[model samples]
Target: MGNLVGSWRFKEPSTVEECDSTWGSDSESDEPVAEDDSGISDSVSPAESERAPGHSGDTSPQLSDSPESAPKMKRSFYAARDLYKYRHSYPNFKKSRQPNEYRNLRFYLNKIPLVPDGIYIEEILSKWRGDYDKLEHNHTYIQWLFPLREQGLNFYAHELTQDEIKEFQSTREAKRRFLAAYSLMLDFYGIKLLDKSGNVARASNWQERFQHLNESHHNYLRITRILKSLGELGYEAFKAPLVRLFLEESLCHNTLPNMQHSVLEYYVYTIRLPATRRRLLRYARKHYRPAHAFLWGPPLKRRGGGVGPEGGVGAGSSGIRAPAPTPEQQRRGEDSPSSPSASSRIIVSSHNAMMCQDLAGGGHKGYAGLGSSMVGLEGTILMAGAQRDRNEYNEIVPL
Candidate 1:
C-alpha cells in the first residue's frame, strides 16, 4: 500500500562468458549486444526484417523456458510407450480369468484341512492327459470319466479353454486306463483295492500286478478297491483302519456287552459277515426250549404212552394207571347223629343250588371245574365235610 510501484534495484552486470560459465551453460557466444541499450539494438538487417513477419520479437520471454521442461516431454513419451507395451502384451487378458482360477485352486488345495477337491481334479486331469484316446471304447471307463469332466468344467467355469477341456477329457481317460491297469496288476498279485464303498475286489495275482506300478502311479489299488467296495455298500471304508483299531481295543479290554453288539453290527454291515446266521440260531434255540419239553424231554411220558426218549412205547406194554375215588369217598359220608350229637345235611341240592353258569350264559350247567375230575373230587369232599359240621349246630350252613 505504501509503494505499489517500487524502485527497480539492479545488480552489477556480468560478462556473457561469466553468466554462461556460472550457470553451467555450454553455448559459445557468437554475437554480442551493447549492455547500455538494455540488450535491445536498433540495427536491423534484411534477413531479420524478413523473419519479423513470423517472429514476435519477444526473445526476452524465452529466458523462462529451460532444460527442465525437456524432462517433462521425455516422461510423456516413456509413459506412452509403457501404455502401448502393456496393451500389446495382454490383448485378451481381460477375457480369461485363468490367473484367478489357478490361484483359487492352489489356495484351496493348500489351505483345506482335509482332502482337497483339487487333488481329485489334478489326478483326473493328469490321467486324462496321459493317453485318453485309448479309453474311448471302454464303457466303464467312459461312464466314470464323463461325470468327472462335468465336475471340472463346472468348477473352473470360464477360466478353462476349449483346448484345456479336450485335454482334461483325455486326461480322465488316461486315469481310467491307469486305474484299470493298476487294478489288474494288483489282481495278478493277489492284492485287493479298498474304496469308499464297502466292497472288496481281490487281485488274485497281486505279485505280477505289482511289477506294472511305477513312481508316477497312485499305486493304491488294494486300498482304493477296498474303499470303493465299502463305499458302494454305504459304509465308511475310509475309516476302516480306525474301526479296526477300536475293535481291537474292545476285544483286548473286554468292554461292555453293548460294545460288542455295536462292533458286531458294524462288522456285519460293513464287512458283510455271517452275523445274521448266528443271531437267528440264538433266537431259535431260545424258543426251542419249551418245545423240547413236550416233544423230547421227560414231559413226553405224561402224555400217555407217547414216544419215549429212545422210541415209541410198545403197544402191548401197559403204562402207569391213575386211581379213581369210590362213591362213599366221593360223597364223604356225613357224621352219624347222637354219636357226637352230629347231623347229616346236604349243602347243595336241586333247590337253592348255585348252578354253574356258562361263560356264554346259555343256561345253568354242571361246573366246568379246573382240570380233570380227580382234582375236582378233592375240593368237593372238603366242602361236604364242612356242611355236615355246620348242620350239627356248630354254624350256619350254605352250599
Candidate 2:
C-alpha cells in the first residue's frame, strides 16, 4: 500500500520491434501474475498488451480525424462539476439576496388569493396603502392597486363600461384584502388609525355601507387619488375636491394639520390652472385656516367696503338672514348713490314699513313710524324697534 502511494517506475520500450517482441508471448508465464478468469493479464500496460492471434501488426488506415469527441467529453465533465457546485450554493446565495420584510409583504400581497369579502379586501388594501408614505414606500404592490380603487370609485360614481368596471373591481378587491391584512398587522404592531371615528370616516366603504370610517383614511385615499390623477393628466387639471377633502378631514381629525395645509399650499403654489389655486385656497381657508395662518397668516381681507358696517356685517343686521350679501345689495352697489361723492354702500334694514305691512297685514302700524326720521338714509339700518314690536305683538296675538 505504501509503495502504491508513491510513483511507480515502469520499463520503457525503446523500439516498436522491442515492444512487439516483449508483448507477443502467447504462452502463460510461470510466475503467474494476477490474471482475470478470461486468462488475460490485468497487470499489463497498454504498450505491453499482446495483439490477438492472426491479427496484423500494421494499424488500419485512419478514416476520420475529428477532435470533437475529446472536447465534448471535457466540456461535459466540467459542466457536471459546475452544476453540482451551483446546487450546493443555491440556498445560501438566495438567502443572502432576499428582500426585506416590507418588500416580502408587498410580494405576497400582490398575489393574494381572491375571495368574496370586499370588506376584507378593502381592509387589507387600506392597511398597506393607508399610511402617508407606505403606499409610496411599498409602491411595487400598492401602485398597481391604487389606480384601480380610483377607477372603481369613478366607475361606481359615473357608471362606466362593464369591462372597465370589471377591471377596476378586480384590482380594488385585491387591494381591499391587502389593506385589511395590513391594517391588522399595524394593529399588531401597536399602530392604529387616529381613532375609531377617524378610521370609520376614512374607510372607503363608509359612505356605501353607511359605516363610519376614519377621516384620515378618507383624506389619504382622496389625496393619493388626486395626485395620481393629476400625474396622469400631466398635472393639467387641478382637482380641488382632493385638497378640499384632505383639508376637511384634517380639520375634523386635527392630525397632521401642517401636512394637510402643505398640500393646500402646494396646490396654491404649483398649480397654474385658472381658479385651481383659488379653489384650493378657499378650501384651505375653510379647513386649514390655523396652519395657513401659521405659514402665511390669514388672507388679507378685501379692502374695498360695500355692504353693511365696516366689520359688523351679519345676516339680521343686513336684513338678508344669510351671511352673503343679498341680490338687491349686490345690484345696489352699481346704482348711482343719492350724492355723487358718497361711497357705494350696502343697506341692512329690518323689514321696511311696506314690507312689514305686506308680511304682517299692518298689525304693527306704529312699528313703521320708528324709521320715519331715517327713511331716506342710504346705509343699512337694523330695525331692532320693529323686531321688538313685532315680537311683542306676536305674543299678544292668538296663534
lDDT of 2 by residue, 118-206 (tens): 22234444454435445333323333333311122222121112233223334544334434543543332223334322231244432
Clashes of 1: 45
> Each model's C-alpha lDDT?
0.26, 0.30
Best by TM-score: 2
Residue-level lDDT tens digits of model 1 in 175-242 = 34334443433343344546523233434543333333211122221222232232221233333442
- Give lDDT: candidate 2, residue 96: 17
Error of 1 at 85 (Å): 66
TM-score against native, each model: 0.15, 0.24
Once fitted onto the true fold, the runs of candidate 1 whose alpha carbons sit more than 4 angstroms away are 1-116, 121-228, 231-246, 254-262, 273-399
Model 2, global lDDT: 0.30
Worst 10 residues of 2 by lDDT: 67-76
